[model samples]
Target: MAQNGSAPVWWKDAVIYQIYPRSFADSNGDGIGDLPGIISHMPYLERLGVDALWISPCFQSPQGDAGYDISDYRKIDPLFGTVADYEALIKEAHDHGLRIIADMVPNHTSDQHVWFKEALASEPGSAARERYLFRDGKGKDGCEPPNNWQSVFGGIAWTQEPERKDGKPRQWYLHLFDSCQPDLNWDNPEVRTEFESVLRFWLDRGVDGFRIDVAHGLIKEKGLPPYTERATMVGEDDDKTPSNAPMWDRDGVHEIYRAWHKLLASYPGDRMLVAEAWVKPLSRLARYVRPDEMQQTFNFDYLLCRWNAAKYREIITDSLEAMHEVGAITAWVMSNHDTVRHASRLGLKDAGARPQGIDAAHEQPDEALGLRRARAVIFMTLGLPGSATLYQGEELGLPDHTKLDRKYRQDPAFFRTDGKEIGRDGCRIPLPWKADGPSLGFNETGELWLPQPEQYKNYAVAVEEKDPDSPLALYRSLLAHRKAFSLGLGALEWAPERKDVVEFCNGPVRVILNCGDKEVTLPEGEILVASHAIEKPGFLPANAAVWMTEKAE
Candidate 1:
């Protein structure tokens, strides 16, 4: 029970902060963040007022696709730390009143995983091969891929194996993502049984929940079929139609979740699971949280919405309505490890335009405007009646490091696209902890896996901590007020007085966010806080958000 049993669910109003372990902090000066580094920063997180921390994968991996290509789901990677270190981090996080949610990537496993290696060594049709989606080639001499499906990173989704020991024809395996990461056959009982055990392993270590990676993609249709509609790796086309591909948001996925729900229910501490589902139609997304499945799913629609008041209101309404219909709380997210930083994305001329590759580095963006909108969008997102996620550095208003040198880029998307797509590395740069330290206090080595921009000095935590009006301060203040007002558990009512403004009431608090090009008048009340300075009384500047006490009718 939480919030005196009124909010009952722990995740309903929790502000969960996502930590990309490789970038958050580095202990032992390894030039990469580790669990000890996370442990050391517990105080900082506690002060930030987040209720939980969703750390990205740190499982034993081959450094392929970052840590998502998990080789051993049961063990922590030496790059991060050992299992004992993870347990320590979990205990410390709990001590600080922060719930720890491990990332469970069940959709696929690293090519180097024992299961995958066994599948490759074993002949086709063997039990070892049955654990994954292994198929035979289809064309003359069986050279072509089983189907026309494409990998999310680029190229064919199916990879042909070397000649088998039995001297049989070449076999192909499905890898919806990178070829180094092979998709598992969720239809197999062995696969299901193993993951259920993996869940218990982490749960036994006292994890509060799991953020299931690629949750909608675990189960594919019985017979793999190519997506008739155009498909993108990021699933941008998923909204065009319901269930477009054999591999995405299939009906069978729910059965797996229902089983997962049962396991989580058996555990103590109200353990939960959230889906990183990119499905379309809030209704379809709602199915993942049908009282007996996932507790929440990322609202990608809100993250992709352009800078428009009407668009924001519509998506928020749809998200809230759909979640309410299913008796689940909505989860709002703006920036994450995969997407461009919202601050930088908002500065671009087109908020929804995704620029990629080295050429995109030269694109001129209005950084000031972007930071303003980034600050304002928090009010809109955090003001909504549900849980919200904050990426590591957004509280400091860090923009995407769009100008990273191409040689330093390591995202599979970049290599797969032959450097044509710079990928998500720009947003994954290590966080700046102190303004004056070598490597900006990320590590004493003055080196990082990915180089940090010299400009990061201004956005460093040390710099922002000293400024009362900094984005960090605003975040801390807003979060404190959010708790004080119970904004997360409050009821939402739209108050549309102007087309350029999105206004809503969460309980007794009124939030007004203006996204238009021109400033607009706002209703008078006890002004709580504004994203940008109020240039004139009774008015809100363009791309600004203000929260105030709701006036009596």
Candidate 2:
């Protein structure tokens, strides 16, 4: 077992890696990544130099939303592993000095959950139904949905239950996401008490902490008013906006987190929570990380910024300022299970456009350009003064499986919109471990839930690990230098920025990124690491970045 004397603020300066378990590795040759598979890869993570691992939801689920629609909070999904396997994984990870942050989905539950099942079977006014957002329909025959709100996936947000055999009109349930995922009513005291116990269940199991899913969507306004605008995955409303949307970033959500913060603080091992709230305006987003609330929240504004130097600088400044006000460190992320991988995203003609998914029919990305920019941005992101999140396979410079066939697509968004939206499956394909294998070494069997592209062979860990110039090598070197300099703990000091370039100093380390088309002369310093090789002395290549320390005397 690992020591529990870790600093309570360790996460502030830690580099936490997000692992999509199903796509990481497969131990049972079941064609799915599981806890055992993750256990086997513990050494690989240690080598990657991340302080913690934020494993996406592995709780018992019906796979309705790739595990987001959880059925049982206390049980591990059979597809992933048994509870014993999870315990083994936690032990193995701790032995490797890596903290485990489990994903906690609080916004909704799978319709198949025991609570939801009981809600469906019981009368409308019963305690069971009150646990979720069940309400009377609006028409004479009770055929209309409770509200005009649309689902994030598509169509109506409300799903009507089957007609009662007793001839009483059935009540409709609220599901902000897919119909299979019914949103729980946070206003219900029973629901709040149930989730608090769930948190304690995992905390007692020796896990480090949790990554809250949809952290902002737990509370809804009174009356469940109709939303006139189109429903989005992340709402635009902020604290300053008048008549804020009823579903997202409501003031009441903070109260829930305050109670959660108190619970986590009581546990040993410095257990913490990272919110996945996509609230607009850096100020509103900062509210989640207030002293008494969540310790950190994902900086979506920084992630969604255009790949321009000015835009990057602006977002970085705004983010740092906002987070500083709350006395909390910002959590920066470029890509994840939901968004397009930065390697491919930055290569698109319009890098600012956030397409749901890419296919052969869509505008193709400039592979080389994208990889170059991705590398540069990562260097700059790491140079910033806060924790960073590296998505799985990002160290290998993995690009989105843009050409994945629609037939193999599994994201609910695709089917919900009748293929109009390409869905997030392209970015969630199983990772390539070997350069050449039937399933690219993702599994012993040649089976894969979502197929890997042939080009992924070039980005395989086996291939990259052998090449010193590969992204994997760069990442390892960067992480080492980052730790050596204590960059994460250092404060940022911005230098007078040049056109198309971002320059800043973190203590003794001076970081320069050339975002322009032409190479820029490097400042006088001892070179520590560069994203791209410096062909000429004192010259930083375009779309490249380098870290340097002050020359001795």
Candidate 3:
């Protein structure tokens, strides 16, 4: 943002460093990471050149589903810090030239929310019951849930909350996420107004923006399904089926966003209201970024692609083509707190077997130089559409160490009745701030939320920051280069000759990446950036890439 206050709240074209508070750092010597812990690392993030930081949910919660289960909208979770500590953080972030956009969970609150408790206490069929998504006799009978839907973590999405009648306790509350994370009855105007007040509370506190959680789940039908078991309706998977098209992509959601825009517009700055819709297809993903809705939304498409040249290029093309709205820019992410880190997702597992064509290090025919080659491709990735978001410790080249021990595991989804798949605890490990410090410099005392992969101690900032070829240094240079390009526009032009080459021309700049193990012949062009073997200008080796502009013919 400009010192003159002309800058917007969107943090447009700026990089956001996502911090998972429980793992970022610990300042109070409490084994768990906290707000003050994150504050201590501000300087590291500053030197890293990120414009803003997106901290995951730190709101008051039962801690059942981590911080996602909010027991109170405006209150702070003691596990993190007090509300004043958070306010001080926002102030500190501003002073350090960084903005803090917090995680806002509006879809639901913990079943412990006063309203839910009161609703549970109220008589059946009363106005209170209508305030939530509930069913009679578990709805449609036969133990069927409201519909055929699954939970994201696993298991049927619906759970019959303990019916509690005022003096007693009776009537179940429906939770779309965990049993405790009951969905708010957005159909009610009162629910809408309640959340609006929550919005104003944070906005009034001078928070820069909000990363809305499960934003799509906020609006669900008021009526129960024609026929379905509660378990089936609550199956644990994203609702791939659009919410009955008419009501699904209805004007209601758009109206919600537009209304927020107006309310937020009253406050100065370009405040952001990013949605976390687990939607699919670039087309569907584009809907959340409606000019009036949200300036930006996550494109899960890029995150799901294979770590290969051909697929990567296709993803780039799809992203650019999908988000061509007049003022709407593109967003790219290789890693996040929710998914496996790019290193492991890209198949760079140290103990794991090699990918088909590429060996353990992705040393395929085109990648003669191993990870260095991939980093070259990533340079172009970071420079492509919208603003790029980097997960914490990604720049240090942290691999997904999600392979957790049975006892240390806390993932609720992993314990679902069906069974367990490794959860995302790997990517959420504490930052390795020092070369060989305890918990990789995460905390002064107490155990880390997750174990630091043995090798991470060497991969810490203290070690990698000094080495030019280190991932950290490379990311630093790449980010600076990306920020230098104000347009942030590029056309992923395919190479005319070789199939292994991926070439993109953005304005006058061109980037070529060789995906094969063998050397690649250079197109007739002038070199601007080269990842490997720049010593000999024209020709590029396997896994090599070069930046270029049209040669002065």
What TM-score, computed on C-alpha atoms, does each candidate reach?
A: 0.96, 0.97, 0.86
RMSD of each: 2.0, 2.5, 5.0
Q: Per-residue lDDT for 305-350 in model 1, tens only? A: 8888788888888888999999999999998998888898889888
| Model 2 lDDT, residue 85, Cα | 91
What's model 2's TM-score? 0.97
Q: Is candidate 1 or 3 superior in TM-score?
A: 1
Runs of candidate 1 exceeding 4 Å displacement: 1-7, 228-242, 356-362, 550-553
Ranked by TM-score, the better of candidates 2 and 3 is: 2
**Candidate 1, number of clashes:** 1
lDDT of 3 by residue, 1-553 (tens): 1244554434557688888898888887666789998887778788788888898999888888888888897988998998998998898888888888889988778877788777776777777766677664444432445455555565666776563434342334566567777777777888888888999999899888888887656665445444232321111232333434322343456667777877776777667777666565567767777666676776666655554667677777777777774346676776677765656544442211221111123332221233454466666666565677788887887765534454665666556633344555656777787866567677777477767767777778889978887888877776776666542543445555457777766666677777676776787877755666565556778766766778796
Query: Where does candidate 2 stray beyond 4 Å?
Result: 1-8, 235-243
The sequence of per-residue lDDT tens digits that candidate 2 reaches over residues 42-120 is 9999998889999999999999999999999999999999889988888898999999899999999999999998988
Q: Which residue pairs in candidate 2 collide?
A: none
